[model samples]
Target: MFPADFAYVRARTLDEALDLLDEAHAADQEAKLIAGGQSLLPMMKLRLAAPQVLIDIADLPELRRGGWMSSVVGGSFGGSIGALSTYRQLGRDALLNGGVIRGRNENVAPHRAEGVPAITDVLTVLADPQVRARGTIGGAVAHGDPASDLPAVLLALNAVLTIASRKGRHPESHLGPYTPRRTRKEPLNIGKREIALDDFLQGIYTTDLADDEIITHIRISHQGGTASAYEKFPHPASHLPLAGVAVVLTYKGGRLTDSNGHVTDLADGSLASAAIAVTGISPRPYRARAAEALLKDAFPTQETLAAAAAQVTTESPGSANRVSLLGDQHASADYRAHLAEVLTRRALAKAIARGGRSL
Candidate 1:
């Protein structure tokens, strides 16, 4: 199948892309932005989406910047990632891999909360080399595919997204006399709005992004004494996650000592916080808050972990009508829900073991 005939425009600058989008919206024309074209191209070829104009922003210098930057927000030091960064770049970057923990008190142990193993772990098995080479982090996220690995990982990290858009252009604007007033062509100083990653994903193939907006950057906090890991069960053919789980644990106090003077117990003061996010099971990826609450302030034993893992399916308690599972040709709802519990337990165990001592 071939897509409908469409006009193509390549944007040289970020502002130019914004202006093009604004014009398309004002004229009441369907326009889509293309970066990496990994997701959009397939949809277009299948005739699922046929836009009047395709605005290519792949060459925009602003979106192409990739590197770690020192970020301090609300007295917490962390890192910011440019949205246009490719998966390959993130996987190979030494800073993103396990490296020196920066912006922390010297007294803190380096192994506790080191680098972003959660991200690197996902990248290692995300897709094949070809896809990783061309796929951009921003594109995968903006597509809002429920099966994508990064969304769940980012949610577990409590990451924040910076969306870029201008105030004058509205997606609902039309070209008639009732058309909204257009502002003068000013320099492309995109107005940025920060949204939490969990809130950003509204549903399957849906997001909080306005039609005219684009994701500009992502920010993640790097708390000391935090350990995180990602695990997934991929579809045999596509390698997309059938069920994926990310776990982040923050530890406090000294190592735990058992009754016999052995230091293998994970007792009360061992874990400070726990964050778990799961994907590829329901209509959308979600944080297992109910399950998280069960694990908090408790000993991380096999029994306790099993109790919490069971809660992964009961996203909300006392709601008999809630449909927490999603069924498809690949797997039944019951099977996926079971997989979620199993994967969550495995991920939690690995994360706890990793967080027990420095990487």
Candidate 2:
């Protein structure tokens, strides 16, 4: 099913895209932005997104141009990751995908781990090099597909998004934070306000986005010494994750203090901070806090799967176990959940292993 006829606009500058966004939003409130047209165009071809206008922004300087090529990290104890990184690129640099991958590959860059098993899985999930090459990090985040891998990766990595309008630029935000009770007001909602990393991105195929908002840039920090992982339950039909999970763990190491003047080999990296982000289970990427606490305490194990399953349900109380196949064959939502649980355990395990015996 081809898309209905629509006006097309090729934006050359940031201002042009912003102006087009305003016009489109005013006219129909559902116009789509095309970056690389990798994701959007196909959706258009299938009539999944029938925007009245297509504003191609892949050519825009802001989204197309990569910054200076320079390595930010280096040392004997802690090595450096080279520039222009990709999941495949990191593997070329000897980065581990998770030491254990639960699913197949999505060969584009989720860029979650410097090198981890989950990263390679995500690269493969995104499919052939041709599609991955044309895909833009900014487009995926803005598209905010719930089943999409990068949304989960960005949420876990605390990747910040920038939105530009006629009013200049403002921070992008998402919605979410599930609770124990169904009675409490859901805390995930974005508004005409400044959004921080922790509070953005609410649920699957959902966001705090407005009709006029256009995503401009993505901001992620290179510090934090985070040991990270990504996991996905990819569809047999599409190879896109039915559910995806990502994790970041920080640990500290130093000389031991005297306890009764005795020192022993409990010397390993002590988890300093930890964050778990899960996609596919909910409307948006959500922090798996309970699973995080368990992983933080015990690292990854078979038991960790139980803890994650518990917490993931907390975020997605309304998910259906049934499958709504788009074609002849596909995976059910329940199967996806099971897959997510598998990836969660592996990703957490991988990050912890990377933490190693730091102390």
Candidate 3:
């Protein structure tokens, strides 16, 4: 199964890639950007996508860097992940693994009680080692694959994506209605737009990315007294999740106590907030707002947790619109919904436990 004939352009830099994409658009030619090629290549091979141009940006150094930052945008301190970062890199990142926070004022990094467990957990199960090694987080999210694990994790984390485009380079400088001027030597006048992870994903294989835009970074905040975990039931053959849930819990005053009820970790005892996101059960991953609202400031007892988990469907109370559950040969809609609840319970329990409590 060979792909259709296309012109392959290996871009040396981000600007070059953007230029090529712009040219393709101006000419009305179908073009696709290639990073890790883990997602796009397979679709091309199957003849599902046959773009006339394949622009490779894998070698662009700017997209490969990943690190912690004091502020990614609007004075929010968190981790800034380069779009080209692979699952292998994310899985091994110390900053994401847990409690180490890099302070903006000083070079010294402080250790915390917990790191981001949900990300590492998802990375471990997101396919075999080979696929994980080559799959870029940006590519997976940009492709808008509902079955992919990372999008749901991002949703639970309340992550933000930085989308870049060459919008301001033209001499008109109107920032409104302007045409791009072609100049090989002129540096790219890059503009950025930040979108919430939940808003960025529209539906199956769809995103908010414009034709000339590319995802530049993913930003996730690390708050004190918060922990996250991911759980999934994956298909045996493809390893894509049949139902996956990512839970992030923020507890304000809960002390890590011993079996005798003695405070072990020296903390408070109040649940502040909870966020749950589920994937692989619908056309797109979505935040379980009803479930989250139920758990907010509520003790995560077995009964309450079960009640919250039951609200995993998009049809939960206060939902804006109804979303149909996706059914396939592998799993029926009823069963998939059931798995969503089960996995949500498991994920919430694990996340709460990581916050030093058990239900």
Specify the highest-TM-score model's number: 3
Q: Rank by TM-score, descending?
A: 3, 1, 2
Q: lDDT tens digits, residues 156-219, model 2?
A: 6566554445543343323322111211321222112334434546544456556666665454
The per-model lDDT (C-alpha) reads: 0.76, 0.55, 0.81
Model 1 CA deviation exceeding 4 Å by range: 66-77, 99-113, 168-189, 254-269, 317-323, 357-359
Per-residue alpha-carbon lDDT of candidate 3 for residues 1-359, written as tens digits (9 for 90 to 100): 99989999999877888899999999999989998899999999999999999999888876776566543222224767989998998877766765455455566555442557898889888998888888998998999988989999899888887766776422322232333333354364766567778878888899877788878778788775577899999999999999999998877653487788887653444468888999998989998888888988787799998998988895666876545798989999999999999998999889878767777
Better of 2 and 3 by TM-score: 3
Per-residue CA lDDT of model 1 for 209-303, tens digit only, reads: 78788776777776655677898999999888888999888765556677999886443445677888888987788898878888777668888
Which window of 10 residues has the lowest lDDT sum in candidate 1?
A: 173-182
Better of 1 and 2 by lDDT: 1
Model 2 clashes, total count? 25
Candidate 3 lDDT at 84 equals 92
Question: Per-candidate TM vs. native?
Answer: 0.83, 0.69, 0.85
Off by over 4 Å in 3: 70-77, 99-113, 168-188, 254-268, 319-322
- The per-residue C-alpha lDDT of model 3 at residue 327 equals 94
Candidate 3's displacement at residue 189, Å, is: 1.7
Q: Give residue 101's lDDT in candidate 2 (0 to 100).
A: 22
Error of 3 at 147 (Å): 0.7
